[model samples]
Target chain A: MDLLPFFQQLEATTVGRVVRESLWMFPVIECVHLLALALLGGAVLLVDLRLLGFGLVNQPVDLLARKADPWLLAAWMVIIATGIPMFLSEATKCYYSPPFFYKIGLLVIASVYTFTYRRRVTRELAYGRAPLTACASLALWFGVGFAGRWIAFY
Target chain B: MNFSAFVQWLDATPGSVALRESMLGYPMIETMHVLTLCLFLGMIALVDLRLLGLGFQSIPVSEVAGRLLPIGLAGFVLMAVSGALLFYSGPIRAYGNIFFRIKMALIMLTGINALVFHYTIYKRVASWDRDPIPPLRARLAGLCSLVLWSAVVVCGRMQAYNWFEKAPGA
Candidate 1:
């Protein structure tokens, strides 16, 4: 699939045009994106910290994960929803931006790690693997955030 | 010295000028500020939600508050340090920015809100720790905190834009 053209066309679309041209639109969407990032960070950290036995230790890991699931899902929804337009507005820039690719790659890895190994360990009360999974999850997500910031600077 | 003079002087200091003009200093501090925000607000949001009987219904409010508030406070310290660096790097610009002023005021309001809840309703957590639904005052505090903090985040993000600064005539 030739994605370069797709990115070019995406940026030329009306949504992209409006987002890029309007003074408030891009910033407003960015604000929502950042707010959701914080929420997502919170949701992910809560469960990860619990798994590491550093947060809500008295509560069952499964229970903490279950409660955080909704918030994590909600924050992801908002982040992606806002993120799309922001990307569309500058798709070409993102296409050429190594940091943007790094962010997306890390986000994919983080999501898969969270739902797969992290979920299973939490479900089965696997204490031995808990710290490792939690640390991995934190590291992957941290990479995503760091790269996201780098995209702006790059 | 007066406030304006202090800010002007602060902005002119070698340290401040170096940080502002350095290739990586401002953005690095900003990244720290933004990243720590997640830890700070994320933990506090959880406590506030529990106070509002929104999430963490299975746990006692006291435990939730006890375990989480300390981490949140630690995050706050990091955030405050990074935030102070950001201000120091550009004292005059930050002091003059309307959004920055609004963000500071909102932060103060949230601080007062947190203190009031801590000294008043939160002091009595043992009474309603397991209720799942706190009393009206406690819930109100939680709601106020959520709203105020959201506003603070909005104002903080707004500081990046030059909406007001681009006014027709300064």
Candidate 2:
């Protein structure tokens, strides 16, 4: 589709103007983005490993999940918050980049898994092992991270 | 060789040359570096929070640490390898960076803190494993590690930009 005008319009906005004009703003936001990703991914993988029966097997699943879940949600919020301004600054470039779409797609899939399959599967300890859900979570989240880095290259 | 000489050597090494030259080499290694942090930092957080009596209190501290150590170490190994490749690919910028030095220092200090915890206070873990609140030393180590690791993350991220790039022989 010829949606280039929409992205160009976004780049003309005040928020986009600030991000593009200020040399330090982009890298500052990027640093925060990476830090938030570290926290979010770390929390997600820790819980997923337990779900896969790899680590923390003998521990109560819900208890550990409870501890990590807060950090995960908070960091997710930060990632989006920081990511938006960066995307807006270079809206046209990101819109045309294949890796940006790939990253967004994986992020959506991973978020769905987190809210649905993961939540249900890890809800009760008596559900035995659900390696499939755990595996999917790992793959989806890691895929999002990988694609995010690829945005810089491709 | 001096520091610059060592860095020059790393930059010229065959593997480093390939990583720097190949289009996908740097990004791929960076992807692995970020991915591995999930295991290294994520696994440690679970056990550290337990030691601090903030998480997984229902489980014994030793068990939490015991189960998570292997996986965390595996992540650390992968992280170190990938991190080395990243550094080797662009040693000039990396070596002159202040944040890089801070990250290295934090890594060394955090490692020593872990070693001390393991050999000493952790030896008496049996007595306090289920205490809900671990011994003062164990909790101190946990807190220190968490803070240090977080700082390292920020430093590593900051080093991505050239904010601290110095002048030539100034």
Candidate 3:
């Protein structure tokens, strides 16, 4: 099906025009997007690395997780808020891009993995045992990062 | 030495041709690069912020650094691999491209800065571990890290716009 026509029509609308004509908007939002990603990535890294017995070997894992959790959530909020508008600006291109599709898929999976498995991982870390869940979380987040990069190329 | 000639030579290499032809190669590499960049920047910020006495004030700086380092390394691996692929895809253009060169230089500087921080300041300041305020040297390193990484990101974003020019009738 010819999707360009639909996109063109959308681009003509007030909301669409804002998306299309807001040239200055995307770059500003992109800056924020990167900043937010840094926050989120940083928080996850701190907790995950501790789980692997890399750093903070003396501290309790649960405490580290609790300490970093708020920053992670806040960063996630910034990422989503800025990301949605950027997505809207080039909805058609992203919708049709395979890399973009994979990025979105990875994002969803990562989110689910974080929310469901994080608690269990924290428990294991607190007990001073090797946590498989933490490893898995790191792997999943790595996948998310990889897929996100793929999106730019596609 | 003429850097432009080196760039031209790199572009003309057979490997460049092979890189460009690989299916989904360029995009895949680019994607990985961005992903790693995110990781690198994110982890660095967290560590530096800790050094500056921001979040995780209760936790020992060494502990936070220890935990965050691996994640940063993982991200670094992704970036290095992906970045190499990107360079391979269009060696000449990327080599000649000012932004790409600047980004590369900054990345190297960032590495040096990191090593220096680890060797000189980290142990001395982190010996106190529980001191809410880190040593001045550590704080200086932290500020530098923040600035250098920000420059890396800006240079990376600028890469898309800086294309190499072709010689006429070559």
Give the winner by lDDT.
1
Q: Ten-residue segment with the worst summed lDDT in candidate 2 chain A?
A: A120-129
lDDT, candidate 3, B1-170, per-residue tens? 48777767777788888778877766666666666665777777888888888778897887767767776777778777777778877877677678887988998898898899888877575476777778888888888888888877767776775234455665
Supply candidate 3's per-residue lDDT for A44: 81
- Runs of candidate 2 with Cα error greater than 4 angstroms are A60-63, A125-127, B166-170
Worst 10 residues of 1 chain B by lDDT: B161-170
| Candidate lDDT values, in order | 0.88, 0.84, 0.74
Of models 1 and 2, which has the larger lDDT? 1
Clashing pairs in 1: none
Residue B107 deviation, candidate 2, in Å?
A: 0.9
Please, what are the lDDT tens digits per residue for candidate 2 over residues A54-143? 777776677667767888898899999999999999999888889999999999989988977788667765426777877998889888
> Pick by DockQ: which candidate is best?
1
For chain B alone, what TM-score does every candidate structure achieve against the true structure? 0.95, 0.93, 0.83
Tens-place lDDT per residue, model 3, A1-154, is 9767775555456654685686456665776677677778778876776677765667788887887888888988898888777776777777667867787787888888776678656755673745576678778777776766655556
Task: Return the candidate ranking by TM-score, descending.
Answer: 1, 2, 3
As a whole number from 0 to 100, the lDDT of residue A108 in candidate 1 is 89
DockQ of the two-chain complex in candidate 1 = 0.76
Report the CA-based lDDT of candidate 2 relative to the real structure.
Answer: 0.84
Give the runs in model 1 whose Cα sits over 4 Å from its true position.
Answer: A126-129, B166-170
- The C-alpha RMSD in Å for every predicted model, in order, reads 1.6, 2.4, 4.0
**Best-fitting candidate, scored by TM-score:** 1
